[model samples]
Target: MVTTAGSAPTPGTILHLREQGFRVVATDIDPAAPGLYLADRGHLVPRGDSEAFLPRMRALCESEGAVAIVPLVDEELLPVGELDGDGLSVMLPRPGFVASCLDKYVLMRELSAAGIGIPRTWSASDPPPADVVADDASGGFVVKPRSGRGSRGVQLVGALAEVPAAVAASGYRADELIVQERVTGPEFTVSVVVWRDGGVQAVVPKEVLLKRGVTKYAVTRHHAEVERTCRAVQSALRADGPFNVQLCLDAEGRPRVFEINPRFSSTAALTVAAGVDEVAGLLRQAVTDGPRLTDTWREGVTMVRRWTDEFISEEEFASHGLAPAPTVPLVARGDDPAPRPRSTDPASGVAVRAR
Candidate 1:
């Protein structure tokens, strides 16, 4: 089962899982989400934060005989983490780790205490004393919500002096935000898949070339230090499931972890293409006696982004009890072909400009 079928990367996950022979059950608040149509069974459900969400999810799990649930969005992690009991596996980190990852300030402090390299971070309400901040190099600071997802509320101040204006513009209380010294370097998104017995399955690092809120274009790179940093994180946090780590290299080439998402990365498909197949592999491990996954994967794999469409007929929409928007045509146009078949060859469609 996969939640938030409307997200950008979820359709790929659902399709891949279906190909692996598991009956995919998809849920979303929007009836017309493309993934809802792609699944073996699709159900319209309340938003993750709503009071009715978990009860409805439990009902769906019982009815569909789902063995596990993959939550695609951050808001659903804490609530869905509760569903891990009763022979049901929630494909997320443990609940305590999930809670820590959600709060950026707390996460940073914990990692710092564990001797993991991280950006110098502080709560906005209790920023470092003036003397500490006075050494501000030309590089500025990053101001963002203490607990949030993606880049929605993030702001880059020109210098320490501009933090007040950025904070006032955000409309959140000072205590609700955090300030960190901005680090400059090429960024990376790393995937660390762990097993139920606290063993690391694989760690794949992708160097991001472009981005919006997530990695847009990335290429697989073999960085020993990056892998070491991520392994250290796993040892320190002990998140006994899949999680994504976002980090950057400092001037000395040491990895400085900036953020950690206690769930699958948006670039999980890239990990599959790199040959780890984390999503399907982890699902198999959760449900039955699956083979143990190894850390070996193809280096120099690249992932590119493009927009594609999924078509559904008007009758099919009505059959699924979804209301169709007038602006969206259910029938395929002459110029529009069916959604292209996914390439089995890892290097078939995307360019591999690995250096």
Candidate 2:
């Protein structure tokens, strides 16, 4: 399987694919993405929005004889989805499903209409009645672009009056934003792996302990109610491949979904380290019709986040197919020269045995 972005989960993905005896090719626009060094081959590509991006990716796939592409970033998801796969598969949900997930308004409306508990969200261009916003303000309201990703443009507002300023600075039209009740409490992330046929193969919920926009600490903890809720949401969405369901528990410990990523999440490696290797599971289904992997992660496994440094000389850096990393970010702490065999261990935690 081919993976792109060459950072975080992409490196973990390359490691996993490598273990399965697949020659993994990693790509990124930035040479300093850090994940490039871990691949069988790496290439510096143009930005996703560049006109040359698509043609270059096509050429890469053709030259590498890549069977499927496992995209690692949301910005490239739709474009990658649109790639003419020929006979190769792009391990992603349908275009409509992806659109629904990316547009939080659509996802919330569809799910809430289906009786799922979702944050009360409304379009900024067409907000709710005055009294409704007043009522929601008691629970803390949030404003963000309608199609925003993660916490990029999210803004917390004390009252509806403050929304206009946030909307103005967002670089999007007022109507292009989404305002909703802030569902705050204890947050959790659910990593789900679905069969190629869109069957729910596995669900592992990790209680989020710390985060700064993205998850920094996630601990594996199984909550039956959240699992049931996620299962229901998954069935309603009919999403395939790997995706994450992020929610915040109510005072009574019930889940209310605030976000859904129709692609693999940044914390995916943490999910694998905690016990469920969603990447491996997807690869198995994508490459072969294999028996599914059941939930078998050790409970209470918590991952701590921090910056790490890897040192490489000019030759080592150029040999792996990436430009030199800037010197300032090095933090001055790593020196090693070891030539090892291709490892698919992922280096996350335990090696998941392919069933």
Judged by TM-score, which candidate is best? 1
lDDT leader: 1
Error of 2 at 349 (Å): 33
**Candidate 1 residue runs with Cα over 4 Å from true position:** 129-131, 311-318, 323-355
lDDT of 2 by residue, 1-355 (tens): 3445445446656767788777776766555545567666665555455455666677777766877788866767787787735777777877777889888888889889878887777888875767665575555778887675667777898777777777887777887788887777789999887855777877889899998777888898889888888888768877766788999987667789988888877787777887677776676666666578777777798888766554657766545533342222222212212221121211211111111
What C-alpha lDDT values do all the predictions have? 0.81, 0.70
Q: In model 1, how large is the Cα lDDT of residue 141?
A: 83
TM-score of each: 0.89, 0.84
Q: Could you tell me how far off, in angstroms, the CA of residue 329 lies in candidate 2 after the best superposition?
A: 23
lDDT tens string, model 1, 1-355?
Answer: 8988777788888889988998888877655467887888777665576566777788888877989999988878898888897989999988888899999999999999999999888888886657547788466889999887888689998788898889888878999999887888879999999966888888999999998877899999999999998989889989898999999887788898989999999999999999999989998898886988899999999999766776777776556655422222234322223321222221122111110
lDDT minimum window of 10 residues, candidate 2: 346-355
